[model samples]
Target: MIAVVQRVNSSWVEVDGKIVGKIGKGINILLGVVKGDTEEDIEKLLKKVPFLRIFEDDKGKMNLSLIDIKGEALVISQFTLAGNVKKGRRPSFDDAEEPERARELYEKFVKKLSEYVPVQTGIFAAHMKVFIENDGPVTFIINSKEL
Candidate 1:
């Protein structure tokens, strides 16, 4: 499992011109599930994401966490994050998990993350237009294997 986590002033996801999920003053997560990802991968992210001290505090230092700031989360399933471009000009998604399994893990991650903060999600497997108003443009790439 891999996540591109961005601190955002606001973010939303639109599918076919209809907004499906939105959030305010929080993190926008683009999540990818690879072939070998399991519940344990979700566990690793759960332990890091909510507690990540990427948000700034009154002192202007990056000291507050999502939980500390009482922020929301917009989780989006982004299978293309698994794309590999190391070999040729074309990107390969051979590492992406099957759709069904990816959806399962994606939902599980959303449900678990919601325990720490309010959470919204984009429709799994849908073509989405994600609009992100990044806060300070702070972003992090989290890999479950690395954690």
Candidate 2:
């Protein structure tokens, strides 16, 4: 499992012109589930994401966490994040998990996250237009295997 976490002042996802998920002053997570991902991978991310001290403290140092600031999260499924682009011009998605299994893990991830803070999500397997106002332009790439 891999997550591209971005600090955002606000963000929303729209599908077919209808807004599906939205959040303010939080992190936007674009999650990808690879072929070998499991519940353990989900658990790893759950332990790290909320407590990440990427937000700023009163002294302008990056010391505050999402939980400390009581922020929300907008989680979106992004199978393309698993694409392997090292070979040719085209990206290969052979590492991405099957749709059904991916959906299950995605939902599980969201449910677990919601327990700690407000959480919203985009439709699974849908074409979405994401609008994000990045805060501090702070972003991080998290991989369960690395954690």
Evaluated with lDDT, which candidate comes out highest? 2
* Candidate 2 structure quality by residue, lDDT tens digits, 63-92: 999999999999999999999999999999
- lDDT tens per residue, model 1, 34-56: 99999999999999999999999
* Model 1: residue 144 alpha-carbon error in angstroms: 0.2
Q: Candidate 2: give the clashing pairs.
A: none
Query: Residue pairs in steric clash, candidate 1?
Result: none
lDDT of 2 at 128: 99
- Provide C-alpha RMSD values for all models, in order: 0.5, 0.5
Error of 1 at 1 (Å): 0.4
